[model samples]
Target: MIAEENFSSCETPFLSISSRAILPHIHMLMKQAIPCFINYIHSENYKKKNLNEDDLTQIYIEQAQILIRKHNYPFNVNGQYRDITNLSKGFSDFYFFPNELGVSTNSIYSVESKRLPAPDKFREKEYVIGNNKNGGIERYKNQIHGKGLNECGLIGFVEKHNFKYWLDLINSWIEDLALSNRNWNEEERLLEIESHVDFCFLHSKAKREEKDIELHHFWIELGNGNSISNSKK
Candidate 1:
């Protein structure tokens, strides 16, 4: 059973605009982009086994750009290192431009993608969320906070076989964070950013061949950032 304590009911103005205004644009983009990505991955003769996280990240970046162009959205995609402050340099996977135009103009939407491998017979089914290192949620926390990025979307890719398992595990992890008291500081940070982050999971049912892959996607918005109500969906 999931505990009620594992959720928050705080609503922020920035989060409200993101949920109401910007999210539809994002959803529309994903509707067109995911299929294009699947087609490209399968049509290309490249070796999927040889692609690393960086390689896959580039692919997502390309797909996002393609969709933006197709829709003629007035935004720029930036992948350069953005100086969050004097001491911290944050590099998001991509940054959309025209930061001053929109209901949430003050909020910047950054994209981050992670490729989680499908578990083999011996391992448990779950995604190890972090940066390059293991067990470092702080890295993402710091990035989001330091960059002052009010909105972020995390794209997660996994093999079709492990997709459902990964989704359940991710939800459990969120619930754990909501209920855990091990780190109040981290918990606070989670609460702070939960209003601004969206989690997306993508998978496909095609066989494991390098050229036979397809992609399916779904996303959930965390936190009680909506003005209508602050409830988890």
Candidate 2:
């Protein structure tokens, strides 16, 4: 782990090592910021109002930025940030950049967010593999999102099921897809790391013809007394 420097000098983190080498530390900051992010959004009266993925994500970033400043996380959040390397690749749902100096380097961590059990049938599989090639996991697999980074994030606004249910369900989708699709593979299934009352963390991998990358899955349960079905998990 890199030594924590005095980020008081600047807004971002200090990167004495390579950008890739410093990502693990940045990841830790995100893990700390996420729970607070979820709490802040729900406190804003999400259950009563209908907030789409983008609206919720923007809210998440807004509060996450506050935490970043309060705790001096040496990183900041940007919603719908464009690819610094290739604009043609389109926008990522969230981009985490170092406080200041590291932003110019390659320390960017790109993440895509999706709603679990999607709103409609046509986009039902979007959290894993979308019908329109816009799936959260699919983008990283195809290198359309996290093109150069070795690790990226998949943020799931779990609108229906619990984390345990989605953990099993998403893996089933990957297993089924691997059987027929040339690009999909069984190894891409998510492995649960830990589950809390507010959030769950999982890990997976994305492999393709060219290369593979590690994927960190974070699911935040937002349903209010509203499990379509019930499970203790």
lDDT of 2 by residue, 1-233 (tens): 99988966655545655557657766676677676666655564554455777776787778777777887765667888677665427678888876656346432788888877687777778888877688888888777898878788978878776888888888899999999987888888899888888888889989966778899987887756222222211
> After aligning candidate 1 to the native by TM-score, how far in Å is the CA of 103 from where it should be?
15
TM-score for all models, in order of appearance: 0.54, 0.83
Instruction: List the lowest-lDDT window of 10 residues for candidate 1.
Output: 224-233
lDDT of each: 0.43, 0.75
Model 1: clashing residue pairs?
Answer: 6-178
Off by over 4 Å in 1: 1-20, 47-49, 84-89, 99-107, 118-140, 143-146, 175-233
Model number with the top TM-score: 2
The residue-by-residue lDDT of candidate 1 on 1-233, one tens digit each, is 97667336543333333433655576567555665655555453542334444555566568878778777764545564354443334455554544333323222555554444422322222232333322223334444312444344555554333444555664466456546634312222211111112344443222211222122234333122212111110
TM-score of 1: 0.54
